[model samples]
Target: MELDRISNLENDITQKIFSYLSIKEAARTSVLSKNWSHKWIVPPCLVFDDENGLSTETIVSHVLLLHNGPIDSFKLSSRKDLDPNDIDQWIHYLSINSIKEIIVKKRNRYSSSYSISSNLFSCQDLTHLELYNCLLQPPSTLKGFGMLKSLHIRRVTVTRDVLEEVISHSPLLEKIILCKLGIRHLKIDAPNVSFLELRGGFEDVELENTINLVEVSIDQKRGSTNSSSLLKFFFKLPRIERLTLQDSFLEGANGSLPKKLPEPCLCLNFLSISIRLNNLEDISTAMCLLRSSPALQELEISVQQDQHVADAAEVTGWLNDKQNRPFTQLRILKVTGFSCVKAEMDFIVFLLLSSPALQQLEISFGRKAVEVVDFSWIYDNQNNGAFMQLRLVKVTGLSGSKAQANFIRILLSSTSTTLERLTLQPAASAKELWELFKLLGEFINRVSVPAVVLEFLDPSNSVQESDDSSSSSDSDDDIGF
Candidate 1:
């Protein structure tokens, strides 16, 4: 006697409601109603993952045969049993159906990689394309993806010409991510690309015409190319807002670095730079980036761990030049791999006093997840800045030494004006959490401002997730990237 309202709904409404459910979950709903079972409106986004025991070849063929209307997105995540010939056929069908996105992550035991055929290029409706571990040969008649906005190619074997053709032809492309391309030279002259994440080896990078590019991250997978100077390289990215330099990309700057870029990154807002604390060149490069980013609001500095850092006495005088000026806009700062060495202390202290507007500070350091023993670290006692703007201070992997306790004591004592929260995570599950508090006496509760929140985090939190996702080719942890 009851009417099947859901089943009787229009096709457009059905698609809208069912689009949120996964393909398998949508299929499971077939038992709810026989009418729904007979005329199932599949979602436009199809992900034929062979991660489970599902046979993609048969399932995909049937889906295309039975399903009507356009497929907006398709991802063929292959672990095995994905025939190369099947790819061309599926892409051909998808091209006719106006597919908007294609993600082919091929990991086949039967073949080295799936050679992407001309059928894919026919999908003129594609806007987002990602191909990993595949062979791409640009079709002579390639008209390019005129509507494409995001292009991600990782571990794919596409010639430099073909790659450039794809980038240059995609007039609307905004995000370009390339990793381990194995290409020695890359000339990116795209007019509209805004975000670029380039990793792996690039002998020469041409970016003169990318005037609209805003965010750029480059990590040299191998050693520096020594082909481009820092001045010449950074001058092109005058509008970059966020920058991350990893590995040896900024090591020597191809020879020498100017004291400052003639034209600084006037728009830069966030910077994450990796460096070695003892290496003069690395420190110099790190400081160069800081000084150039006059508008910088957030900064993350990751130091190379497990090395003998030079004594602060040796590095402090050279570092006292106050090169970290113009960080008046800086609000947040984070440092990782900070051993309680005097050099690390000096750098932190120098930065702390430099940014009068600095608000939050987080420091995480330790070679391992073991309880910290007092290193008997000694530093020249200096008065802390007013820190009138500093609010939140979090220190992880802290070695519970009287010296470290005194360091916290000084920060707490001076931040009486604006300090709000203090979070401490020990190197391991150390009983020294209590001992450190005892060493501070009743000073922890004496902040003159409003209540100061104190939190003791688990030491395990100090050890970052051990999963090496950056080097993983198959991991989809960073889907957006």
Candidate 2:
């Protein structure tokens, strides 16, 4: 009966059983029945996590003894202190087994050192590889790993030449992610890469070939002398459809800008960027980016606390140009951490005025109090019936200040006819939200439009409190919002 049950168990069930059991427990399963004895020899996948009281050497030995067939996937991670050679041996063993996918992660314990042999890159069957805090030496020649499609390396020491060699060899590569690496220069030769993400300090990315790229997210290093150099390479990609730049410094020490901005001829339909600068020239660089994006339909911009709007006049001026700079196709706009300063307000107001087709506007105020700026002037001056197309307005992080409340009242009075959904965040109480909803409901009833949907997205409940303790001292260039 036990033999029958063991035979009836599928490979997935057997693997799940092995996942929870230690080497001893799994070996003990062999004695359960004659049919179960050798069943562990050819399991489809192997996973070893040292969290369960198993020694790294013992786990590695058990894996080598039982792994007899081509491994479809292998994951080896150690939570306990381990020797770097133990990891290298494990990787070497998996490579010999023709593993298709491999993931190895060492716990961030006391700054441990680990290294990978260049031979590991020659694994012909490897299609995906990810390493965390593993020291790697570039292969002498990018010989094998011809099937590799994705590679992610974090906190690794990588040389620029090796990086270029890897890219040149991986012709079918689709995605690459690098974080906090020592690589100073990156030149991607793969024309078929679809997605790329780079995050680190002062690394210059110089791509030699035009890629058939679709999406790119760059969180540039702050206060780095190489910021402009990095941006130049990023913008050179020929066919990027989506671009996101976060917490990047664009001006040099003497406020000189890069000679040219990245220009993608394709209509950029979506863009999200956060610019942090102390000078006016930095704003010009940002405006240059926006002006180059002719087909942007959805845009999200986050300006930091210290970044003033007064210095960003060039960007606002470009936006205010009704004939040349009108966002005729823009449909959605979201601005977060806004201070309602004249520069910020003017920029938004200009965008609102220019975006004749805009349907939704979402803004989150940062501080507690402010003088209300009435946007009723927009309705009075709107041409081509642009104000009539406005449908939804959402404001989050409200503090119940008179200025904020008055601003909400002005929007309600002005666009109530077409406004369909209105949402507010951080409302003091459910009762308060209910009362506000009632007042807005009555106002909407008078307008004869559909009942305005009033929602209270309480930031206290939704926003994670634990994140508040974490410092934003790290460069914000990488996270555009």
Top candidate by lDDT: 1
Residue-wise C-alpha lDDT for candidate 2, range 377-467, written one tens digit per residue: 3333333233556788888766555445545665676576688888888534223444445555666677675567777676665332111
- lDDT tens per residue, model 1, 317-337: 777877446479999998876
Which regions in candidate 2 have their CA more than 4 angstroms from the true location?
1-57, 60-64, 67-69, 77-81, 107-110, 138-144, 249-264, 276-282, 307-324, 365-387, 427-448, 458-461, 464-481
lDDT of 2 at 142: 64
Q: Give TM per candidate.
A: 0.87, 0.77
lDDT of 2 at 103: 76
Report residue 421 deviation for candidate 1 (angstroms): 1.9
Local lDDT at 400 for model 2:
56
CA displacement after TM-score superposition, residue 462 of candidate 2 (Å): 2.1
